[model samples]
Target chain A: MSWNVGVWIASLLTLAIYSFLYKDNPFYKVAENIFVGVSAGYWAVVLWFDFTWPNLFEPLINRGNVISLIPIIVGLMMFAPLIPKISWLVRIPLTFTMGVAMALVVTQRIQGEIFPQLQATFLPLAGVSPGVLISNLLIIIGVIATLIYFYFSKEHKGVLGFGAKLGIWFMMIAFGASFGYTVMARISLLIGRVYFLLHNWLGII
Target chain B: MKQTLPLFIVFGCGFFMIIAFFIPLGGFQDVSQTFENWYTGVIAFFVFVGILNLVRVNTERIQKRTRDWQYSIILLIFLGIMMVAGFFIGGREGRLFLYLFDNFYIPLGATMFSLLAFFVASAAFRAFRARTPEATLLLIAAVIVMIGRVPVGYWIWHGFPSLVEWVMNVPNTAAKRGILFGADLGLISMALRVLLGIERSYMGGGKE
Candidate 1:
């Protein structure tokens, strides 16, 4: 098919979705459902080809690798649930596989998610400008306050209470800032798409 | 039956996912990796389940000719077509799939994500109203930070740039850390509740 025909189909589909902003309509629903179907199908294909086939099938069939058969058997165990009589067997593989995977992710996630963040908090106040000093102090203060705001069980009294209040304030500000940033990030992608329609696909530009 | 069972599971996953990091036990690495893989598979299964639910709901609505039943028909048609294309011809053989993805999917996803722009603008306009002492202070802080992040804002005020850096480095980071700590604490508490069978969110709801 010509790019022109493809662009026409795409543009119409996009417009159909945008019509959703006014109110829920048939066009938008069509677009939304198409999106969900396509994405799901794409994922299933990717997984089978990238993972189940190449890793398990190729190894077991071509190389006669026996250990590779273990995952394959364990994975196939997932279908045991389809057989009501053997449904409990499905849990064995599911739990074992996911349990190990979760442990692995958490171990790595702690370093990626927590460590750098914690390190960033150790701010040196001096040798920096007066503005920097005040800001750093505020950061330390805000963190304490926000943490307090989230505190449950214990009733925060006096200083802790005040800290919690500050935390809430800091949170709102942070959310507002983040909300603003997210807007720009989202808009840029939209602009890129629109640009494609007008210039690359349509050649109107 | 209720949503509680699912909530507990969510809490449990979040908790263990966090806890597994601190323990540093032998064999933890391999175990967690496997868990991650399983999580992905579980998520994929749910994706299909969700669609089944959608079709069920929409089909009922369409049969009744609900006020906007027309859209449901379109949805079904588009959905069926994509499912057929994907299952039969997905890889390079599914060149049509790639074509549709590039031409249709990317733009649609972009448009959905872009809705945030209008929402943010509306939110900011509301925030700037400064109805109270906190709001006023926040407005001031926001203005300072926004100007500081950008080159033009700093160019005009000069000091605004450095001021913005201080705001982010000190106050912003501290505040974020505090929130994270609180979130971590909450996750632990919730996880404990679930493990104890108080907060069942995953058993498809005996709500146990």
Candidate 2:
């Protein structure tokens, strides 16, 4: 086996974190804390370089842009929570974020997500192949029944109940499939680390 | 005054953004774009806020000599190292930053999430119980999907993958869409409530 120092370090850190799977220990705690600290620092760097510098600080310094000061102040206000007396000032930034996010989402969501999916649901049964046609029919039925299942306005004792029951079956199938897919994804990550350890660190390949 | 002012700000910002989307005029659009940039800038500071919170919590833990206080010291040391490397040397592109990130952060992150693989097996075992008709259907679907997605299922039967694909594309997509539509409508209503200042729980003290 041949390995570089970086690979050895990386492998050790990886194993330290994976030690949690066996049981929590000092090594796992150190690894977890290090990850948290490093990630936070990385994000802080990203924010400074990407948004704060380019959008706010640079503009104010270079162009004499006073408007940028507003955001800078509000942004600083986000740290108000660190102080007990003036912590309520944090609300300014939070409200701004929430308000803008809501506005953006409300406007774009219909066009971006809802309408596109709604349009997709209206599939051509006649022109498509038999398999596709059946799929389309299933999609239509499943969507309607699922919608009915979520509709809590009615008592759901008769026809609605039947539709809701069918919806549950469809939802269960979907959830199961989703869970299966997630398992596959997690396994892929595990495989990547295993590959790293075996090929890069131990050179067992 | 405190409560009312924040609500008004929320309403004003939300209302203006919604209007700006539809208007698309030069002057109005420019203002909207500026506000959007400011929003981005403000949101970026949230990283610092988060880091501050982390530091405060960890520092407090260490001061109290809480369980695993030594680990918090290790955390602060790494955090200080990374921050110094990032701020002084430069962010990820710097030699020290890249070295630490590549050696420590990436591997740890990958391994941490990869640990989910073990948990997933335990979760699957518990979740796959065929108690009711619905539960049986879920278990069956899960098993089929799991088997069909892999090479073993392909080797066992050529049709398994196709069957799995059909299941995923048809029923899965349908149910997801139905849930999304309902959920999004709920989201819109909630957003409206917040924008209108009816949802004051976000103001932290629940005084609205």
Candidate 3:
């Protein structure tokens, strides 16, 4: 009974939200705001549980690990914004964060993405089937053509332009394929949720 | 603090992270663990900012009595009611918050995603004309991908199944990664600038 009641409530709210397809109505906006507020509050608690409380307070109280505090101080620097008097202290943390994030983002791109993609260009076709060989060759050609399309230092008149054009088509196809796959994945999840609510939640099954 | 302060913070954090990568500094783990913690705090901070922005926009609309002012009213009301429910009645025991999150927010976000579907379909249908080689290829590739993705492609041709796989795994991955890699490089540069106080644009660039 408890489960059924919960599922019924959930299903009703789900229907209220799905009604948004027609237009942006009060029901959707109310739901949207509630979501925003609740998410914020939940996140605040989680942040404390995950990071601030765990590293800062937990150590100070339980472990008495005072030496492990310089970084915590650095982090508390973020709260400097609240102290209108010494808000400049915030710069210490903000600057460090952005810089580190940027560095990580960039270096990871090179070491992880660039090297692997470069490796993908070299295809071993000796023992491969005819179909696989053709596919690999087409991929190589597509990459070259796509690169040519972007070369605008000179006019894309004859061969280069044609190749670039082919590249564009290839890119489009790739995007469409990814989009489809993503939609399928999301829809599958949604279907699972519905199935749970109908059968497990309400025992309709 | 002014935006330049953020720059210094960025620089300091970046320098420390780099050092950590090469040499396991005396308290490197402590420093790095702090970095991990930053994610939740940062996300929480952004969530606050988002709510603030939402309230600010809707409040102004209400004050001005705009065309959709009524909708804004409903928004604020819903936001208010949800907080009350979660805080007073539900607490952590109930799924009042989670219910709203998954049922409402998720669907709404998904619809926003699906909205792109109509836009893409319309754009392809109208914009994709066989005027040039590139355009023609795009049309052909779009068709192939469309076919390759669905069960129809397998029925029509045997090669398409593998063709789709190759397109996604190879050329597609390369091009996308190239763009992403460039973006990462740009972010690193910006982060460095902020750390060094060289880039003051984020702060709205005051006297500092």
Candidate 4:
């Protein structure tokens, strides 16, 4: 029902991808390859215009920031792998990036996740309602039990074994909940696509 | 020089960042910010590297007349069209670019993810069996969560939603917190190892 070429293209592409549900065919392959190509091109344009151009090139060219050249030169060094003779030059940039990334991870993990989680886990047991008290106790025990389960260094025996077993039960429940949420999210996406097909393309809704 | 130099760079950069976290004075923060920007700029070029590699591989396939090489041509054409529309035209704000992105890219991407729903459901049928006590518990939890998440559960029982909330907030949080603690500890140690040059795996296999 829609006369828009864009909508038609979208509808066709969606159907082409969904065709894979039946079996692998030329339509699916074409769609799949187009996805890959377009995704790569999209990222290329984004990184160039949004990131490298503005952050790296603009500063150096317009603002006359000589320091920006450091990253630009290092970035150009990333292409060293394409030339076999000086391929070892690639490690410099790789190591530089890895160092910064790993450092950020360490600092952020401690400051963000570890401290807050540990603080939350150490809840006051006294002066709470019956339901809240039970919930808090369960949370504390469950956390300890789950941690014990992941303690591969210790041999599972006696109390440790019991704690580990309890941990598995808690983890199993958590994983199941996570899986359910994931499936529901995917189903929601499916519903959206179906709505688009019926309402936008076919005008049957 | 290659091996030692990289190790030194890692130590230098990593330690600087860590130190900068503590010492926010005397331009340490500024230097750290610059390093962060440098990392972003360097990493941005990797996208082009990826695209170049993709082009190389597809061109090689076309040259060799490999199976399904015809699809490669279509892929290249689309890639070129998008790049031209994005770069040579009016940029990302260009009409053709936005049209392709809104219609072609978004629909295809959404459909691809949505297709996983069917496969996941099919897999769940085979895998969600209650063979053991643990499996039984998992199945029960999953069913409860799935039901309570939707509107139909409210029609069945008013209490289902509150029950689901309690399960998520308490037990789920407990398990997730435990996992997070363990993982973050491991990550910190691994990061330290890399900084100290004890983890050489990332550098790949080669002679010093």
Candidate 5:
């Protein structure tokens, strides 16, 4: 088995973080803090090299793109909070950012998620096999009932209430499936650690 | 100066971008794309701001000698080391940077998330109690899905995997799609409220 100092360091840090399962301790805290600091620093460097330099600075300097200055100035306005006298200036950029995101997402989400999902639910009911027919029927009932559950304009009574009740069952099952899937994911991660320790570190596997 | 200006800025940029999406004109699309690049740069600035804030907070903690302030020193050291490695030595492609990332960062992140397995087990133990009819339904479904997902269940019964697949594809998809539709509709309405300046909370507080 091949062994190295980097692998040793990784194994120890992995163990240190896992030590948190027993209780909170210095090893865990140190590992946690280092993780945060390193991640932030890494991302900061990435943003500068990947985004700011190529997209913002290069254009402004090489091409004399004066328009790039507008965002640079607005971005600097975000730091107005550091100066008590000009704190309110931060609001301008914040509003612009929020508004732009809102506008873009409003249209994009409809086009991407809402429209496609609705179209997908248009399963052909006629001229299909028994299994396909049953599945399609379940999907239709499930969608309509779930939508009814969320409808707040009118009080749920009789048929509407029954549909809502059915909706709740479907929702509960979905949530349960999600929970199970998450548990499986977590267990898979744990298995990875175990495999690393056994195969890489101990050479036992 | 405080309120009205920001609202107007939001209105102008928000409406302009939305209108640009519809218009096939060159100037509109160019303006929209340029503003998008600007937004991207502005977002990059916020990352710097975030790092600065973290440094400031940690520095203050170390200076004041707060609880476990020594850890803060370690954090700053690693942060500085990482930045120097990335910026001066080379970007992430550098040997030292990749060494630190592959060994230190990857292990820490993986172990951190792996720790959740233990907690999730304990949490599931508590959650699986069938106190009500709905709770019972949830518990039963969860148990079935969990069992069906693992190989041991298939060992006990060969049909477990297919049963799990059916549950996931049919009921789960239907339920999730329904929830997504409702949620997206609400999201659009909220976005509209923000664009219209009815929701000024993004400026720090209630509508102004």
Candidate 6:
């Protein structure tokens, strides 16, 4: 078995968190609070070392990039909310961030998601094996039917209703598959923790 | 003056990015790259804001002697320890910081997420009823997927894996693509509204 202090501490903490399965108690709360605190501190260190030091401070101080000061000053403006008199100054940084973020989303969605998906959906159905042809036809039909289901402008009646019904079936199947995969992922994580308990901490395995 | 200045900044930055996307010529790309870096820098400072807010809230709770105020003390203590280890000892390369992350953080994080497996399974048991044809299809799909993904599934039937693959590739892709198209169209329009200053909700409420 491992005699390492770190491993011991980790094992205790893991058990502390898992004790919540029995009931909510002080140990679980302590573990939860520690998790929150450590996570916040970790992010702070990462932001300072990985982001601010390298991107903002290094460029402004060492490389003498005057333009870097623009963001630094704006970033500092985020602290304006601490002061009642000039709290509105925070809006500047907020708007700047929002503008850039929104613009990127618009362009990226068009180029990355919308176009590629449409291209993939519009496959040629000319020459192929019977199985390949059936699969391709299903894909094309499924996409159109699903789109038609989401089309709320026209009421679902007659052929539109049939298409919408087909769409619901397709979506239900997809959602079921997604849920199954997610469950497996979580179970795998549980298995990993169990393995750590048995093999690493106790040496049973 | 406050509101107008911010709105103007939004318009300027938003239009510049959209234009730069189309052009990408001369110094446009370089300036755009700089702006991207600046965005990252600005966003980084929010982490400090968040940590400070967390500290302030916990400190208040301790002072008020709220329910389980003792936990706040532990939280602040660990937060301080992590920050000290990170800054003084060294950032990522520091022995103490890395030890805390590898032992404390990883185990806690993984265990927390893994606990969801029990809840998900319980929920599935209750909710996976086949009252309708659609529900039956969903149940069938889920069972096939779960069984086919594991080694025991192949022992039961050779074709289980391929059927699962077909369900994923065809129906899953189609459903996801349809949703994505609808969602992206809405997002693009909303983004345009923000750019044009029609959506002023982000600026918060006040006079002008």
Clashing pairs in 4: none
Which candidate would rank higher by lDDT, 3 or 6? 6
**Candidate that would win on DockQ:** 4
Cα lDDT tens digits for candidate 5, B1-208: 6898998888888889889988979999998888777777788888888999999999999999999999999889999999999988978688888888888888788888888888988998977888987788778778778899888989999998887887788778888889999999999999888888898777885334
DockQ of each two-chain model: 0.31, 0.76, 0.29, 0.81, 0.72, 0.79
Candidate 2 accuracy as TM-score:
0.96
Error of 3 at B117 (Å): 4.4
- Tell me the tens digit of each residue's lDDT in model 4 across B1-208: 9899999999999999999999979699999998998888789887888898899999999999999999999899989989999999889999988877898789989999999999999999999999998998788888888888889988899888887898888888999999999999999999999999999788776556
Looking at model 4, what is the TM-score of chain A?
0.96
* Minimal lDDT window, size 10, model 5 chain B: B199-208
Q: How would you class the docking of model 5? A: medium
RMSD (CA, Å), each prediction:
5.5, 1.5, 4.8, 1.2, 1.8, 1.3
**Tens digit per residue, CA lDDT, model 6, A1-205:** 8998988988889899899999999999999999998999888998888888887889989999998889999999989889978989989889998889888988899999999999999877888888888888888888888898999999999999999999998889889999888888998999999899998999999
Complex DockQ, candidate 3: 0.29
Tell me how far the alpha carbon of residue A49 in candidate 4 is from the true structure, in angstroms, after superposition.
2.9
Ordered by lDDT, highest first, the candidates read 4, 6, 2, 5, 1, 3
True contacts kept of each: 0.34, 0.74, 0.28, 0.79, 0.73, 0.78
Question: If ranked by TM-score, best first, what sequence of candidates would result?
Answer: 4, 6, 2, 5, 1, 3
For model 6, the superposed segments whose C-alpha errors exceed 4 Å read: none
- The residue pairs found clashing in candidate 5 are none
Off by over 4 Å in 1: A1-3, A22-25, A47-111, A127-129, A153-156, A200-205, B1-39, B52-70, B90-93, B123-128, B138-169, B192-199, B206-208
Quote model 5's TM-score. Answer: 0.95
Predicted candidate 1 versus true structure: per-residue lDDT over A1-205, tens digit per residue = 2267777777777677778768878777777877765665555556655556665667678999676666666566666555676555554344443444444444444566567667777789889998668777788778778877877658888887887778878876776455434555665766766776677666778
Displacement of residue A34 (Cα, Å) in model 1 is: 2.7
Off by over 4 Å in 2: B206-208
Share of the reference A-B contacts seen in candidate 1: 0.34
Fraction of native contacts in model 4? 0.79
What are the per-residue Cα lDDT tens digits for candidate 1 across B35-136?
465455444443454566667777998999887777667666656665666667665358766776776677677766665566666778866877876776
Give the distance in Å from residue A18's predicted Cα in candidate 1 to where it truly belongs: 2.8
Q: Please write out the lDDT profile of model 6 over residues B101-145, one tens digit for every residue.
A: 999889999999999998899999999999999999889888988
Model 5 alpha-carbon drift over 4 Å, by segment: B205-208
